[model samples]
Target chain A: MMSDKEPLFSAKNRKLLTNPLGSDNPITIQVLGICSALAVTAKLEPAIVMSISVMAVLALANVIVSLLRNTIPSRIRIIVQLVIVAALVILVDQILKAFAYDVSKQLSVFVGLIITNCIIMGRLEAFALGNKPWPAFLDGIGNAAGYGIILVIVAFFRELLGSGTLYGFKVIPQAFYDMGYQNNGLMILPPMALITVGIIIWVQRSRNKSLIES
Target chain B: MNTQSNTYTFLYAAIMVVIVAAVLSFTSLTLKDRQNMNKEIEKKQNILKAVNVTSTPANAVELFDKYIVEAIIVNSEGEVKSNDKAETFKVDLKHENKKDLSKRKLPVFVFNDTKVGKKLIIPVRGKGMWGPIWGFISMESDRKTIYGATFDHKGETPGLGAEISKPEFQKPFTGKQIFDESGVFTSLKLVKGTASNNPHAFDAVSGGTVTSKGLEAMLQDNLSSYEKFLKSSK
Candidate 1:
């Protein structure tokens, strides 16, 4: 029996888990999931839902792809990945429509748009295609968390400043509005999401010099 | 056996497709009942919303049964037919909207408004900027003036066309006359800029011209089915 071999959360696996949340961030650094980040971040509720949906889909797809890695033909692997992602996305959409009608209403077609999110395919092609099932699952969760972190951060600022609310709660007091405080309407617009992402990237790079490129 | 052979690739793709298809269908079928229940509750909520009722999904059914007094189907001749609440509540607006006005069976919900007394709510369906838009408009006892309205859309652009569902956009519809003094059905107008000094007009949503226009048309077309009922009932 292997004595005290590499732990499940091995140093390398831990790096796989943590790296995506920082220097190799999916949204800030890799810019893989910017479209949904911009679209769903207008409201915190949808952002959280989208984040959770992506996390679930990504982790499941990764495990499935990793299991089929050997038998997958290189030429048709992309299609196979797409099929897996699309199926998972539809299932998620159905569940949301059943249980989260209001949220699903706001999300509308964006739930279906999850199929187009680059991060799922990117992870499947880059990591899952060549990795073991366990490592692939970790990579999926890590990358999705990286994307979700940015989504939540962007949504936090957007909903608070743009709507004067957090997750539809009136956190910004009515007194502020009565005293001539104004919500920045631009924050709710899609361009502001891009700008917010850029600002996050800026702050992160400045803090960690290793993240900056020459 | 050549691992890279086309036969192997074809088999792999075939098997994958079959598995994905089976799983997706199973999920969809299992969830169909729950999804339909959600839709029914939301429909109740929207109808209730048109009459200034606030309800969550948990309480929507109870509130709907308590508030909605009767559901009736009316034809283009404005003749009220069957009053089966269950059957009428389940009528598909899209399917009915496609039929010729003369043959279409329009479903109307009679809501006993605590504030305004009795109001009849007619559901309207139309196109929006990006997708389908629909809502319920409750007319006062006179059946000529709007008591309240609620609009919802599938995929209208937020902050623009989607503003139709907002309180500010819908508030103006109240007390607005849908018909002229001479009893001519002019249908309410959606003034683009402002609706000041207009007894029969409401302000169209800014930056949501298509959705606004769609709502206007939807109200006019759908309401015409109740013309005779309104005239006779009055």
Candidate 2:
């Protein structure tokens, strides 16, 4: 139990919020939810929308699961977590369709596919089940931000090089295309997403030598 | 309570399911109207797109009302069944496509714009590489050559098959004739390659062969029924 005297953003709690942004990153270090990374990163806009959706799902799922951690029957914890995540995803998808219709259309089935994203399950089983609601929420935000940052980075390069556009706006000058500059078609394909993630992993591991396995 | 007991697990599962179901159903019920409205607006926008009229979600309804001078539902025999705009617009093409062509309620929208002129817009539905693909194809006043087209897919591969929805693919459909010089219904074809010189076909997306073929078949199947209507209108 968190004591009344304990500050809300205590040092330990801060690490829960910050660690996943770098050294303990979910996508690069843990590599949990790579399916969506490959699926939605073709364009920058969908990637950003997807990142926000996943963050919302993850943070809420973490808090809910954490609040019920003790009362949850250990024998059926996984099922409970799945139910919560699925419910939240459906809610998000409905809300998106009602309000952000265009983005919802761009996302389409992938929002429903969020129920299958492993990071939410992994966080619930690992951190939320063991930690208090506050730390669980922080961890959720941290890991989701980690995933979002990488998605944004990959989408940035993909949209810029593949489509010569960012968020559907033409960023590369027409003069370049007039001068025979061609967008890299390969970068637009799904295979290129894996390669981009691979490069990010390689660069991160090389810089943080401790991340390398013995 | 023994949380680990089988009874406890069963109760927990049952209660969780009840809560989740309630939440989901409530959400769906509350948002159904707004979601349906969005879909209706998107359909109107797509219909307008077939005539090369650009519209945002905010202005789609107004533009649709302004540009669509008539919505006519016709049968396979080229006989008009209804001309009520709302009734024709609400005709669900996905369901209509499933019926025999003779029994289908095929909707035709006459878009009247001072600059773009009056064009006939028809809806087409077919399978894509991943899922259902549908689009609107607008024909010029000649009732032969396509004026504009707009295609959308449920789940085609992002940069490949899904390119059918992009302008680069749809733009080439303009000026493509669905009838031969003899006035026979040929339907438009998505040629596999090198279709620049072909007036009846457009180049298919390079990496989207299956989707291209599916779209081609869709045009053939959907447009053949409208042959009588097109000819009679002309």
Report, for all candidates in order, the number of backbone clashes. 0, 0
Looking at model 2 chain A, report the run of 10 residues with the lowest lDDT sum: A1-10
The DockQ figures for the candidates are 0.73, 0.88
lDDT of 1 by residue, A1-214 (tens): 5776668998999998999999899998888988989988998988888888899999999999999898898778899999999998888889889888887887787788789999999899999999999999999999999999999999999999999999989999899989999999999899999999999999998999987778
Q: List the residue pairs that clash in candidate 1.
A: none
RMSD of candidates 1 onward, in order: 2.0, 1.9
Put down candidate 1 lDDT per residue, B1-234, tens digits, no spaces: 455789988998999999999999999999999999999999999999999999999999999999999999878787777899998998898999898878888888999956769988989898888889999999888889888999999888877898988898888788888789999888888886677669788788877888889988888887777787777764
TM-score: which candidate is best? Answer: 2
Model 2 complex DockQ against the native: 0.88
User: For residues A1-214, could you state the per-residue lDDT of candidate 2 as single tens digits?
Assistant: 6566668899999998888989999999999999989988989988898888899999999999999999999977898999899889988889988998888888887898789889999999999999888989999999999999999999999999999999999999999999999999999888999999999999999999999989
Top DockQ model:
2
